[model samples]
Target: MRVLLVAYGSRGDVEPMVGFAVQLRALGAEVQMCAPPDFAELLEGVGIPLAPIGQPVRPVVKGVVTGTAPMPAEGLPQRAAALVATTYDAVAAVAEGFDAVVATGLLPAAAGARSVAEKLGILYSFVAYFPTYLPSPHHPPFERPGRPFPPEVTDNRALWELDFETMNVLFGTGLNTHRASIGLPPVDDFRGYVLTGRPWLATDPALSPWPEPADIDVVQTGAWFRPDERPLPADLVAFLEGGPVPVYVGFGSIPVRDSADVARAAIEAVRAHGRRVIVSGGWADLDLIDDQGDCLAVGEVNHHVLFRRVAAVVHHGGAGTTTTAARAGAPQVVVPQMADQPYWAGRVADLGIGAAHDGPTPTFESLVAALETALAPETAARAAALSGMVRTDGATAAAKLLFDAVLTAEPQQ
Candidate 1:
């Protein structure tokens, strides 16, 4: 079978699809990816053919993180329309002869991919990295700018209804316009059309379970993760061997505000607990607080391996980072910035695996307090216990499911 995996957004969004693609190839299926060009190096290293889609994501994300970008409500319709058109063109250009197109990431892009699959009469599936993207009475939908729910409307069902309406309002025109141009029927309900009834939830059930008795019949595939086999840098290895295990701090792809301040607070907090600090200079570009020997700044390394050696993982609780830490049995201090981060943070706290900082910005005192909980012996024990339960074969499972679906649908000779 030939498959096209489409993902658009940040590294967290694209990395899981890479894992799924790798697994599909291992299962003897041909796989290609359509994602932002920011991950070209990552894809090249893994040897997956990439069809670059949309603009580079880093500058856009950096703009949002640093308050230089337009607000979410500013010209959203234009942006949404352009994104849909871009995605459609990118996917349609290379979609011929493919058996399936599995899409995840931003909704607008997914909608475009689905439309192309429809036009080509091929199979299409939408997968979400978190449960919040799926409509469920268990939780309320995320409030969008210029579309806040009424004060009196607290019911989850009602809020979800509002969510659908918002989706239509934001994306319907663009989707239908493109559909018309492509000789396809208009999509009346954008959300329903994009997230079909059986959208796959690619999250670890042990860490982020879909609540029972919910609205949609979600296909809960465990988190799609690719094991990182890159050995730690020589300097990092020396740092680990040089001292007692240090707290590992990094915000992954998030462009954290006041990075120097955050780095200082993290270093001080780790020092307060008598531990060293290994700071990852992700998109935030975090660095050592004061050229101190106790703290080290690094670029991308193997989180799967580094997390295991850390005293604790302090980060901006992205789903990928949180899951990596959980799998490594490393306690966490989750400082949520936006989107699904707070959800992951809450999970960490609820599971007794770590501490959830109250908000995004971490003061010296707050970091110290959160680290106190993360470094606790009980937290470490719980983290270790949970590590044994995290499924590492999510990509393989999802790949087999997709392959089987294709095989079953093929007309018998």
Candidate 2:
């Protein structure tokens, strides 16, 4: 079977798919991932074969905060022709000849998958990294602007319910109006557009429910790990072995408003509690002051590989990261910066596997307190128990779902 894995966004989004890809290959399935252009080498370097696509998705979420395009319209269909003109060629390039196409992130890839799969008569499935399948029905809204929602709307469900007028504004008279200049037919929603999975609903497994019927095959596969994880970094391995188990502090792809402040506070907390620190800066840099001698600031460490030896894991609550930490048997302290972070924060705290620093990440005192709980003996024991229980064959589960539910379904065409 040929599996076409389509993903966008940063390393956090693309890396987990690698786990699935590696597992699929072992099962005699040909798996190829098409990610942002910049990830091409990193994927190759890690020995995971990939098909490169479009520009890199830089800190676009940060772009929204930085006042770039009103919000996270960094690369989306907000301006009608914006998506059509840019994504048509991209969709046209990688859309053909796959048993199934799976994607994540915003509308372009999902829409593109639908369009291309329809034309090729293949299956399309979307895998959400977090639960944005629909707007939060039971919580305060993220007032962030330029969300996939159009300018004319207020309530999330209203924007989701695109009326005919909104459709006209969206699609206009032509399928690819701007493409006419380059000579191409206009396009509309592509094909088999299903947001097939919701991994985190406000961090509560129960809340992540989809309003859409189960007909679309939107099932959670839990978190997956690649069969081909790189051996742990020499430095990380030595550090873990050399010291008392440290609390791991790092945000994944998402950034905080103040990295320095976060680092300082984390270092202080570590000293106060008499513990070493392993900071995985991830995309952000965390070079501490000379005074922070014991707090090791760093970047680009894989959680699956790093969490096994760490005592307590503290981080921004990306589903993949949190899940890996849990599976590794490490208690966590979550300082959710935005979106699903808060949700996961609550779940971890409630589950007794970790603690949450609600909203804007609470004060340093809260973080210190949460870390104390995370580092406690009982918390460590619970996390260790959870590690043994997760059945994290995410890759296998997803592959099974695709083969049985999607690829085997009647062709979309």
Candidate 3:
């Protein structure tokens, strides 16, 4: 079968799609990918043929991390429109011969993919990295912006109903406008568009055990991981060996306004408790006072390997990083920025495996308190236990399910 995978967003969003492409190819399906231009090297490194998506994602991601972007409720439609325009041409090409098209459940990609699939009568499936897109009475809505709601909000599904209604008003016009231009009928309800088909939930049930009802055919695959496994640098190995297990701190792809302040907070918090640190200078430019101190500021390193050796992890709660931390049996300290981040933070705190800082901007005192809670013995024990029980064949399972869905949708000879 020929398949086209559409994934547009930050590095955190595209990396998992690369893993699914690799697995599908291994399972004998012809697979190609469409993503933002910045991820070309990453796709090439994994040997997947790439079709470029237009608008660059770096500026938007940087803006959000640095506090320049619009709030989620206010700016999502504009972002969605940009992504849809980039996705239209590539998805149109896929419609000619592809058996299936799957997309990351970001609003723009999902909207564009659905349009193309409907126009061509091909199977389209939604892949969610977290359960935020799927609504349930058991948990809060995915993108609850501003201050969090009351503790009793979980018992009220009307909040979800209201959010969905607001979503339709915010996003429906752009989606339907695009659909009409392409000779497709208007999608009356955007919420209906989102929850219509069998959307694949790409998360471990142990980590996000949402009680999805029998009516919704949600595929609960574990976290999808990348194919490459580069060895740690010799200097990093030496740093690891030189002292006690250091706390791993990195906010992958989320740029900060003052990286030095954040790095200093991390370094001071760890050292105050007599521990060492390994700081990942993600998109931000973080420089420590001295290279020879207990803390070492380095560029990107392999999280799969480094997380295993670390005592705990402190990060911005992107879905990919959160899953990696959980898989490595390391406790997490979540300093959320926007969108689904705060949801993951809530999950961590609920599970008793980590502490979530209350504010988007973390102060020294808050970071210190969160780190102390994350390093507790009970948190470590819970993380380790959960890691042992969570399934690891996410890529394989996702590939098989997509292939099956296509075959089933096709008319038999």
lDDT of each: 0.90, 0.63, 0.78
| Cα shift from native, residue 224, model 2 (Å) | 2.3
In candidate 3, stretches whose alpha carbon ends up further than 4 angstroms from where it belongs are 69-79, 142-155, 410-413
lDDT of 2 at 76: 28
Ranking, TM-score, top scorer first: 1, 3, 2
> Which candidate has the highest TM-score of all?
1
| Most accurate candidate by lDDT | 1
Per-residue lDDT tens digits of candidate 3, residues 1-413? 98888887788888888888888999899888888888888888878888877767788778766778745756667756666756877778655788888878466676787778777788877788887677666555654443345556555476677677766766777787787788888776676575555677888788876575633566788878875589988989998999899998888877777788888887788777778988887776656746666887777678888898998898888888888889889899998877778888988898988999896777778888998899999999999987787667898899988777777785111
Clashing pairs in 1: none
Scored against the true structure, residue 227 in model 1 reaches a CA lDDT of: 61
User: Each model's number of backbone clashes?
Assistant: 0, 10, 0
Write one digit per residue (lDDT tens) for candidate 2, span 1-413. 77777676666678777877777777777777777776886678657666665655665555543345344333224543454434545656765666777666544445554455556667766666554443333332343323344566666555434432334344443334554565545544322233423322212133233445432343566566655466777877777787787778887777666667777787678767888888766554554645544667666655677788787887888777787787788898888776667767776888798888766544568778887888889998988887777765667777666667554574433
RMSD of each: 2.0, 4.9, 3.0
In Å, residue 331's CA in model 2 sits off its true spot by 1.2
lDDT of 1 by residue, 32-117 (tens): 99999999999999989999997898989888777887467857877888899999999999999999999988899999999889
Per-residue error at 204 for model 2, in Å? 12
For model 1 the local lDDT of residue 158 reads: 92
